[model samples]
Target: MKNLTKKIRSKKLESKVDLTAMVSVSFLLIVFFMVTIDLAKPKGIGLGLPDKNPEWDGKIVCGMGMGDRLVTILLDDNNKLVSYQGLLSYPNEKPKTLSYDANGIRKELHNKKRLIQEYYGDTSRGPIVIIKPSKKCNYKNLIDILDEMAVAKIDTYSIINDFTPEESQLLAAN
Candidate 1:
């Protein structure tokens, strides 16, 4: 009779060890981690368009080897801003070198932005400025042009180059 009583007491004690609290704590921990974790995302500056292959079907126009409706910025051997068909230029005389001041570049960019809006009606289709620097052009001038591009929020840009097929084939072979 004593053995039976002891067995009953042991069984009751075993059943009383509640696992509900442990399960609740585990669930709370899982939720906390989920809330604190950050979702992985791509890191970089976003561009206006997707990447295109070297042999893309798009036609190459303008002196910069880009399609039509592109803004072309040509730099002569003297490093002067000669003509830009896409962006508006000051009347009478052409500026040799753009000032390094941010405000100056911003003002010019704003004017260009307005012109582009009027021409295309969509500013999001950002104007593609092609930089065609003459062989004898100063390297500093190129840097200035790049700076202006950044200030103007002009992202789509390309450099003009003329490579012979034989040269290209040699490069490919290498």
Candidate 2:
């Protein structure tokens, strides 16, 4: 009788679970993944277009390798793109004139960008572009060419208001 009473008085204990460590570890893992993940960047071309200043001097200032790996694009008021490589003194050949079609400027830009990248892994020493926009070219043509440069992922390009006499003559002939 005494043993039976003792057994009836005893109660079974319940087990407790501690999830604090698990919660902390989960938070740490989340932070680690977030820090390692890479975010998508916006697509746009960053051009080196010089600002117009009143006190400017007239000089044929050329950048490094401007004559060799130079990509010259002349824009007319008619939205025509006259493109070529090397200097304006290349009297032996004429620049290719193309419309602003999908197969036109964009294709040429992509090719030039690829070649420059392949030859020189360092973009700082890659191909340089000279954009000679004639007074005849409308504002839209300028914007479109800039957009094409962005699409091609070119890193180096400039807009020159000063057109050489040789370039002017060549453009006139075209």
Candidate 3:
């Protein structure tokens, strides 16, 4: 007779999940990132600070006279930027307030560059920028000005902390 009760069956179901593919994919992704990504590459403005040579006398010395090519940028509080061509004592151009934007400092730089090239009859010579940050001037302003120098393609720039008496008076007046 057909079995009245179905034969007792014991079925075993495997519930284990295979994670080999997932681990392999994760490993592959890690390797891909390691190969594709640049690691610890330093990125920032390159500054060439002048070395204090024992031979250097206390004078504004360069290949040629810098009086005409000098562009002193004084960073004051409230993001105020004062720039002038030549020395503060006897400026080639009077001190004028300039912004860090394209029309302000950038345009000034470009104009100065063109003027210097024309006057000197040399395309390679650019203005010598002296960046002087006041006591109240924040670090961001300093960085922005430096970035501007880079954007303006200024070759010779000096970040001088020690301001002269005239420069100090100018900043205070501003």
Per-candidate TM-scores read: 0.43, 0.58, 0.62
How far in Å is the alpha carbon of 18 misplaced in model 1?
A: 23
**Superposed Cα deviation of residue 154, candidate 1 (Å):** 0.7
User: Compared with the true structure, what per-residue lDDT tens digits does model 1 show for residues 1-174?
Assistant: 446555434444445777999999999999888866744445577544433436656644333322324555555445454334433322222322444456454466667667666755676756666776665568887888788888787877777754335323323332
Pairs of colliding residues, candidate 2: 77-136, 77-137
TM-score of 3: 0.62
Best by TM-score: 3
Model 1 poorest 10 in a row by lDDT: 87-96
Task: Provide the clash count, candidate 1.
Answer: 1
- Comparing 2 with 3 on lDDT, the higher-scoring candidate is 3
For candidate 2, give the lDDT of residue 23: 100
RMSD of 2: 9.4
Candidate models: Cα lDDT each: 0.56, 0.74, 0.83
Mind giving the per-residue lDDT tens digits that candidate 2 earns over 115-142? 7667656455555778889999899999
Per residue, candidate 3 scores C-alpha lDDT tens digits across 1-174 of 887788888999989999999999999999888866755466677433233345666443453256788899999889999999887777887899999899999899989989988987877777889999988899999999988889889889999888888988887887
lDDT of 2: 0.74
Per-residue lDDT, model 2, residue 17, is 95
Query: Which parts of model 3 have CA positions greater than 4 angstroms off?
Result: 1-64
